[model samples]
Target: MFHMNRIFRHSHLTPYEADYAQWCAEQGALLREGRLSDLDRENLAEEIESLGRSDKREIESRLKVLLVHLLKLQFQAKQVKEGWRSTVVEQRRRIRKLIKESPSLRSYPMQVLAEEYEYARSDAAGETGLPARVFPENCPYDIDDILDLDFYPQAVGSAGGQSDLA
Candidate 1:
């Protein structure tokens, strides 16, 4: 009985620190019961803010994957594979869905694309066995072009059409 009492007391002191899932359940119950005084307001607010950050990170990661595959298609036209095309399509779909679901994030796509473009460029060069210099120092495709389903960059020097990067 004494050990059980001690355990219960310890859990009440810092429920959020002790067990996150239990903390969430307890917070929900508190909200439902109108026990505002018992809710972990600080931690709850932090978690909610973290959720927004998580969405931003997701957008950035998907953009990077899309850009990398696009670069591969542009620079290695001879080696273009179905898998690369599929990835580019899938990432664009996911990014579009994310923005549609969270309209407040409508402006985030361009910001994330610019921030992640360098990493994507480096990754594309590494994956394609091409010199980093082979790719442009800055992103060649605009955000709209990158997300366009019909957009595929032409290969450098195709029909005398040099890449903007070239």
Candidate 2:
């Protein structure tokens, strides 16, 4: 169970004590969603509390601030998740594309390549036209590959072999 009580105070809450509850709630929700904020939580609470009055002017002003902050929190979560997800997804897509493109790797049987890459045979098949169960042990393949030496600068020829080091 939770508790909330209100008592009028002649002296103002110095900002920190004023909006603790709302800030705590917002932060709890954000953390539950696996997000973080760099701003001062105490200050944010104070600002949010200013939005709680019954007067039209006070309510509107505070409501605007609260809405903006809420939107910011939601947007931050979205952007962070999307940014991280896209990075992983794009890297995976790139690796699959490379396996399909590499001449040496292409020489190997689709099953053999799929096992070595740890990708699903089905995914490999989709990318390389091979069967999903062609690899060792007949275990279902997920067709995902981790970044390996082939993606390194030297292996990719970006460093022009050992000559760049010399």
Best by lDDT: 1
Residues 1-166 of candidate 2: C-alpha lDDT, one tens digit per residue: 1222222233222333567675455445444545444334666566566543223232233223322222222223322233433433454445445446554433233434334334333343454343544333343222221223122111112334422211
Query: Model 1 compared with the native: what TM-score?
Result: 0.84
Q: Write the per-residue lDDT of candidate 1 for residues 74-163, one digit (tens) a residue.
A: 989888887987898899899899999899998898977767899999999899999999999999999998988768787865666544
Return the TM-score for each candidate structure. 0.84, 0.18
Q: Please list the residue runs of candidate 2 whose C-alpha ends up more than 4 Å from where it truly belongs after superposition.
A: 1-25, 28-119, 137-145, 149-166
Q: Which lDDT value does model 1 have at 113?
A: 74
Q: List runs of model 1 lying over 4 Å from the truth.
A: 1-14, 160-166
Tell me which residue pairs clash in candidate 2: 51-62, 119-143, 119-144, 120-141, 120-142, 120-143, 121-141
| Model 1: ten consecutive residues of lowest lDDT | 1-10
- The window of 10 residues in a row where model 2 has the poorest summed lDDT is 148-157
